[model samples]
Target chain A: MIRFDRVSKRYPPGVDALSDISFEVAEREMVLVSGHSGAGKSTLLKLIAAVEKSTGGAVLVGGQNVSGLARAALPYLRRRIGMVFQDQKLLFDRNAFENVMLPLSITGFPRREAAQRVRAALDKVGLSSREKALPVMLSGGEQQRLAIARAVVGRPKLLLADEPTAHLDADTAADVARIFKEFNHVGVTVLIATYAGDLFPGARRLQLEHGKLLP
Target chain B: MTAWLAQHGDAVRLAMRRLASAPVNSLLYLLAIGVALALPAGGQMLLANALSLAGTTSAVPHISVFMAANADRGMAAEIESRLKKRGDIKRVQFLPREETLARMKANPGLRDVIEALAANPFPDAFVLAVADERPEAMERLAVELRQLPRVEHVQLDSAWVRRLDALLQLGRTAVLVLGVLLSAGLIAISFSIIRMQVLTHRTEIEVSGLLGATDGFIRRPFLYYGLLLGLGGGIVAWLLVGAAALWLRAPLGELVRLYDLTLVLQTPGTRDSALLLAFAAGLGWLGAIISLQQHLRKS
Candidate 1:
């Protein structure tokens, strides 16, 4: 669950990334934050994740004010929410399985259990066969799938994805969208930020333009 | 507990793998640390052996009490008896004027000079071995002996011992200063190595941080790397010092033989070796921590 109350973010030299944004998403709800490039979609996601602090107003996740959270406490908060970046952020040096295993490793999951969970997540993302292949060796779609597997492997309650289907084929994008839907169907709350709102039809859309949210 | 150990085990394995990836570079770094640490460690070993030799060669200090030239054998006997009765004096040997003259005449260089003298000019004397070898104690004993009747002078025969002790003390201090400076150099080397490693793995570190990795988790592998490097260097240093000691033993033995001293060149003992390794490892860990703090704070 996430709530933003009149949140505003300003970069140095007086550039506004997000302005007077107020929104709320209930638990187990999958919401699409539709925005053009530089429309504050990424900034909103970052605020919820506490990756960056809000310049003004309160940003709450799971009834906790993340805007005021201490830096030392950020890691614990992040562990509860999985993030899939636009760039994939998959370590190219490691194989697909190791990439997916990273989150479990961070949490110190038991080796046997972590391996099983990683395999299952890979299977869910249709990356089970390419688990041993490095990211550079994999196709673009497969890399995105590997990143998704890594994000979901830890079984985080809330999932945040930024442009998850960017630079992919139409069919591949549909497949990626289907995986997010499947996760939401299983009661995992998901927030996806994308310019291509058509990929996620029928989902509640919060559109943003020029750092301001549209009604 | 098992999970904690598993995490640490994973970190250590990762560190080892990273080190193995660059074997030549790692070996060169280890050699640098080894040579630096060996300098002071080897000096300390030699100094210790020298001190031990000095102690063994002069275990007891001696004092010479010379009787007046006019004093007779009866006065010499009385003074020797008095010295032998003292608890502080371990042993006293009386040298009569005739015996002294005859002993001096036996020396080739002194024989011609002694034969020129018409009469026995040497005085009766007593050589005393004292229990306390401290300079102050020896001086006090000499002053006491000089006050005896028929005694012309008392000489404390430990000036050379005191000089050797002072020189050895200076050597120890020099070694200590060298060790401290070299330790700083070792720490700087570790810091630079870790800094480069962190920069090389910058992307990986950022990804790890984003994936809910704690600072400790990110720092664990680098710390282990530093610790391993230091430990390996310590091993190399210990070997180098040991080998040097072995190589120098025969030469040192010949040199000491000239002075009638059975000095042995000794390698560092087990406890000292362990301490060196531990100290090196600690420095490596400290370097890693400092480097991580600088970069991790920026992230």
Candidate 2:
């Protein structure tokens, strides 16, 4: 469960990126955040991921108040909440399997179990055969799947995606949305932020404009 | 999952591989840090050996006090007694004018010159020895001895003593200043190496952080990199100092043999080596701290 209550994020000198927001994401549900450019989609995801704290109000993830967490422990908060970026952000120097294994390493899981889990995650993301390939070698859709595989490897209770399907073709985007839906059905809450015309209609849709959400 | 070490072992290994990706850069930093540490360490070993040689020579440090023309034996005796009673002093002896003239005359060509001196022109003198051959104590003794009423002159046999003392002090000051300067250099060395690694691996860091890696997890391998460089540099320094010490041993021994004195070069001992290891660890830790400040700031 994730909740943002009257959350307002402002940069220095008072430029409000997001203001007076209140929202709740239920457990095991998939939600699509539709927004145009500079609509605060990424900022909202960053707040849930604990990458950046909100300037005001509470951010609660999995019953833990994340807004008050110390910087050193912010990663622990993130560990429970997975994040996927538009840019895959894979270490170009490493292979796909290694890329997926990153989050497991963060929590200090040992090699054998981490390898096993990486394989399972890759299989789930339909990249089981591309484990040895680099991000550059993979197609756009493949790289996005690799990013999702890496995010879900930790078995996080929550997943936040910022434009997960932005660069993919229609069919590929639909496939990616299906993966999020499947993960949600298995009791993991998923949040996708995108301006893409395609929307997985069965999932909850939140349209945002200029940092405000329209009912 | 520190307890899940067996579970997440591969990812940790992968992290290490990720750092080792650029072998050329790592090697370059290792060599740079090693050379920086070696230079100062070699200088310290040279000074240590020199001091050891000066010490074991066991030469005496003494002061000579010449009495006034009208000074009587009683006043001279009083001054000697006074010096002897002080704990700061080890021994004091009064040499009469005749003994001094006789000793000088023991030379083959001094007979006529000594005979021309109708009476004993040289005054009675007190020759003093200190407990330890140090300048400050000897200087203080000289000061007190000169204050005596009957003494006309206080001449210290201090040429070699003062020279040795000055050299040792200069070495100490050098170590102090150089240690600080070298430590600062080490900081810069570690910072650059880490900064480069961070730059090359920025994508890796971002990906890991996005995937839920904490600041600590992100920092581990780089911290290890700092340690590796620091320890490597320290080992190189020790080897350099050790090799120089070995090279100088023969020539130093030969020189001392001509004077019939036996002294070994005082290389930094085991305790010193342990200190070097500790210093290496400290250098690595300090470097890691600096790098973490920058990385975590952005992450």
Candidate 3:
């Protein structure tokens, strides 16, 4: 449920992070945005998530213009879309369960239901036993899994992951990729940005070079 | 309404947890707020006592109209009749020179002193009890009596009472200014503490923001933190002022007994305690709102 009408993101000092990129990912479609470092994959996802506005053309998520969305409306837009940053962005002070429960809490889910859903999500990510362990206590793969649980706990329709498996070993990356595939299989629109498009088999690939979409 | 209560309850719980995370720091901040509030409160209490003492110790106000030495008996009679006609004078008692001398002679040691005088030195006087005890009204009556033909001097005996009232008024204003300054200081201290807490929880806050948390959601716990600190400080201040008042009660009672003055310290009552708590909570909430506006904008 995302469409970009020739979206372009330009930074100061004449730097173009993304230029004239247009694409669409239909509902429940699993896609991979393959790009090298600084190829504007993150910018594209950020534009869809409404984290960063498109400078030139319009970006639409859920049929609404992301560029024109009011500040008060950004939260609703973000609530519909789950985001995973490359750095994991897990709270080091809290245990794994709290990190996963954050999004549910933000949405004001009942505590009992929220705990149940958090447990289910953590279970899906194979983090059930480590629920009480802090992020510092988890391995890189487990932290990535924790982030995925947090992002998906709200059951966002669209999942935007930026280099989610960046620092993982091949097997762990495969495991993480499998988790994404599982969510996508359940009718969630998933667009993953990664250099290893080969990791996500049978998914539509949108390759980018210098922010321009390649056929 | 249920949901609103639940939300606030959750926020308060979280705030308590956050405050409990750093017990020592919270206690110190609370103590600072308490001491700041206590200073003005103590000042106000002492001033109240001073005012009450002034009220009791001052003599009953009266106006003394003294007739000139050369004035005749007819002039004295006419003056007394004129004073009795005025509505301002509720009662007028004439004291003849012979009676004034005889009363002085009755005093134990003053008998010899009065006999040494060749003649009665006391002049004919009228002691006028005025209708109003107000200082202004008494002063006005004294002014009117001075203009009487045979009246040599008019004494408004409430002059020292008026001066004490003025001094007490000045003290009340000083206490008010001190209270205002301390309130500002309390707010500033809470603001600083909230700012530090925001810094400490920066990542959690940012993550929550990213997860579509509303600004109100993000600000709720911090506001509660400020409010709790302020409230704790208020309680400490109340206890401190109460204890100090208790400690001073004995000493103050002894001092008043020595002076034969009917005055006692009026400790802060329920209304005062309630006001102190309300003020602390208000300042804490305000500080939290300010800090949240600043730091949340950055996030």
Candidate 4:
């Protein structure tokens, strides 16, 4: 669950990234944030993840005030939230399996348990056979799927994906949407930021324009 | 506890893998650290042997108590016997004036000078070897001997010993300063290498940060990396010192024999080696920690 009350983020030299934004997402809810470039979607996700502090008001995730969280406590708060960026930030030096296992490894899961979960996550992302392949060897669509698998491998309470399917084809995009729905059905709150509004039909949509939530 | 150990094991394995990924670079770093460490460690070994040799040789500080020229042989005997009874005196030998003159005549260059003297100017003396060769100890013995009625003068061979001690002290200070400077350089080198590693993995680090990885989790492998480098450097330094000692052992033994002294060249012992290894490792860890702070702040 996430709640934002008049949260604002302002950069140096008079640039407003997010201005008085307010929103709420219930437990296990699936919501798509549709916004154009510079619409503060990324900033909003960062606030929830505690990656960046909000300039004004409060942002809460899992009932803890994220805006006022201490630096030492940020990691623990982040552990329960999964985030995906558009860059696909996969470590190419390692194989696909290693990339997917990063989240679970960070949490210090046992070796055998990590391996099994990594395999299961890969299989779920349709990357079971490509576990040994490097990120450089994977196609764009497969890379995005790998990122998704990594984001959810730790079974985080909330998932925040920024333009996850931006570079994928229609079929791959729909496949990604199906994965999100599958996760939401099992009580994992999911928030996706993308400009394509039709990607997730029947899902709640929160539109933002120039850092403000649209009515 | 088991899980914590398992995590550390994983970190160590991962660090090894990371190091192996760039063999040439890692080896070069290790060599730099080894050479820096070897200088002081090697110097310490050599200086220890030299100091021990200086202690064992004729450089042992002693006092010579000279009796009055008119003093009888009975007085010299009395002094020798009295000195022999003291626990601080390791040995006391009486040298009669006639015997001293005869011994001087045996020296080819001193014969003419000795024969030219009108009277046997040499006086009855006692040569004392003290258990403690410290300047103060020798001076104390000399002061006590000077108080004797028949004694003309008490000469303590302390000046030369004092000079040698001063030189040895200077050598120790030099070694210490060298050690400190080299260690600082080693830490700096390790810091640079770790900073580069972090830069290379910048994206991965940021991603992990976003994935809820703790700062300690991110820093674990680099810390291990620093520790491994330090340990490797320590081993290399020890080997270099050992090899040098091995090469010099026989020659040094011959020199010691020529000087009529007992001293043996030795490599570092277990405790010394462990200390070097642990110190190097600690430096590496410190460097990695410093770099981690800088890089993590940015992330």
Could you say which candidate leads in TM-score?
Answer: 1
Off by over 4 Å in 2: A6-21, A35-38, A52-59, A63-70, A195-199, B1-20, B60-159, B249-268
The fnat scores of all predictions, in order, read 0.72, 0.77, 0.63, 0.77
Ranking by TM-score: 1, 3, 4, 2
Clashes of each: 0, 10, 0, 0
lDDT of 4: 0.88
Query: Superposing all C-alpha atoms, what RMSD in Å does each candidate have to the true structure?
Result: 2.1, 5.1, 2.6, 2.9
Error of 3 at A7 (Å): 0.4
lDDT of 3 by residue, A139-164 (tens): 99999999999999999899999998
lDDT (10s digit) by residue, model 3, range B113-200: 8899887888999888899999888887788789999789999888877787788889989999999999999888988899999999
Using DockQ as the measure, which candidate wins? 1
Scanning candidate 1 chain B in windows of ten residues, the lowest lDDT window is: B53-62
What's the TM-score of every candidate structure? 0.95, 0.77, 0.92, 0.91
Ranking by lDDT: 1, 3, 4, 2
The DockQ of each candidate is 0.79, 0.49, 0.64, 0.71
In CAPRI terms, model 3 is classed as: medium
Instruction: Please give the TM-score that candidate 4 achieves against the real structure.
Output: 0.91
Model with the higher TM-score, candidate 1 or 4: 1
Question: For model 3, how many clashes?
Answer: 0
Predicted candidate 2 versus true structure: per-residue lDDT over B201-266, tens digit per residue? 777777677666666667777776676678777887787778777877788888878888775665
